[model samples]
Target: MDRPRCVWVRKADARVPGKLPIVYSKSYAVRFHGLERLHPFNAAKGKHIYKALCAEFSLAEGSFYEPEELTKHQLRRIHTRQYLRSLRWSLNVARIAEVSLMAFVPNNYLNHFYLRPMRFQAAGSILAGKLALDYGWAINLGGGFHHCCSNRGGGFCAYADISLLIVRLFDQEQCRVRRIMIVDLDAHQGNGHERDFSNWDTVYILDIYNALIYPRDNVAKLSIRSGAELPNHTEDATYLRQLGRCLMQSLAAFRPDVVIYNAGTDILKGDPLGNMDITAEGVIERDRLVFSTFRGLGIPVVMLLSGGYTKASARVITDSIVNLRQHGLLDLSPL
Candidate 1:
């Protein structure tokens, strides 16, 4: 039986004719009473990358795709209603955010200043997934909220953007995208999506993470179709070799219609959380390998900027994106 095209996939607007398939929004910045300064993690990563891309790629403000905030209805598609409601509580949000001060902040400012940016980023992920199908590749300058699942939100992730993107694509582009693969290269384990898609054969997860880090859900490891758990301080060679092998093995095991690459720079040497020794050049090469493997096979790929804690993380990510362009893995020329 033929399937009808789903309406959830946003149609391309005429405003972005010369723009590449890069999804971003000014709202992606989490600015609230200078409280973003309190957190060690960089909250304005999307804005940093946007500025870098603007300077490097010769892009204007309106050149990128601006994603509307994801309404509760959209998030409810993957996340549980209880989980969504839990976000309204300052205590719950603070814990999920790993910011103690967030608990003191009132719900009005909490919801508006902090979670709203996340919603925009989450929606950007969904938009990127849709754009990837039309173009060969798409990049959501913000997103990769892998720490949130259907029933839970942890680590700094309040919404399961990865899960939502795949589910939306499955529900919308079902005929063309019957199967999708999540290549989570973040330094921390992607237990959220792992738990959400557990026992689901249609979604294959390839999570290469530092097994020693946070949310080391041994149970969630069961869902990974193929992946690697590196020890603390694993270097570039070992990391990339294992990644190459994993990509080859996962592709051989599952012929996916689309690939979701969680490109996280937290794996860099100085990152306090990632606990790995991968250099900036190593990070750039890592992105190239992932993009090459998927796009080379004619599979649509969506790149999400996931975990990156250090101040230099944004520069690393921006350099990697430029590397992808230079290597011909990402041709941002308007389709």
Candidate 2:
């Protein structure tokens, strides 16, 4: 069997400085611990994890290929023009106001600056998807901003990267490929994805999440709900079993042409944001199941590291990437 080709996209600017003040009053300090206020920690931890994985796998250090800037015309394919314009203005105004009418602007002046990079990040994922069609696999180490909607942003996500990419692919007359399966294991419901792609027959989404968490409404509203919306404090074995079953069912039904995976590490035990309890080994096993399952079905996969919090959580995610590389789940052949 031939090895699959993987594209790793990481931009240094993607790591921006915190300009928003921590809102201490949003949630109860006891249960929530104001951890959500520590928004930059996850991104920092992700950088550490990526570095460790590169060293461990002896993978060549590669910079992200620059992608074309997302134009207003391109964004209009998925987002309403009015909404797009509003976001543009809100980003500029968000630096002064802690909150905006339709969206939360933690930092008024820096909103646009903080989110501006998502255009490139999203373009990278789109490129990765296209590359996967030829390479059999591609890994986008950063992306998976699944909580952002066409008109709203929340949950630390500012742009709907994969959704926009899917829309763009559909609009291109020459891109004949159809039937995309989005496998979201981010420990949170793929609200943004489900909302955008629900009516599109060619796109099928399988999202696994902790039921008792933020964005709870998303699980109930999935067009094709396949996985258990497990409760908080669920053990590792139970979660993995359910995930395996869901993957099997999705494979049998969708028989998709391509797989887009949101490999989030928040399910790890003691994750700052996640409520579930999964071990590092458990995360690796979950990755193996999803990647190997898609490969066995003869569908190419493009993986994006979605959401992971805490220091060790990133290490667990990095381990999964390394495992994929070692087992040839990710293509390493010279391009």
TM-score for all models, in order of appearance: 0.95, 0.79
Where does candidate 1 clash, by residue pair?
none
* Residues 44-119, model 1: lDDT tens digits: 8888998999999988678888899999899889988888889889999999988898999898899999999999
In candidate 1, how many Å is residue 303 off?
0.5
CA-lDDT, candidates in order = 0.89, 0.65
In angstroms, how far off is 100's CA in candidate 1?
1.3
RMSD to true structure for each model, in Å: 2.7, 9.3
Off by over 4 Å in 1: 1-16
Candidate 2 clashing pairs, residues 3+ apart or interchain: 4-331, 5-331, 94-107, 94-108, 94-109, 95-107, 95-108, 95-109, 96-108
lDDT of 2 at 283: 91
Model 1 CA lDDT for position 105: 88
For candidate 2, the per-residue lDDT at 139 reads: 66
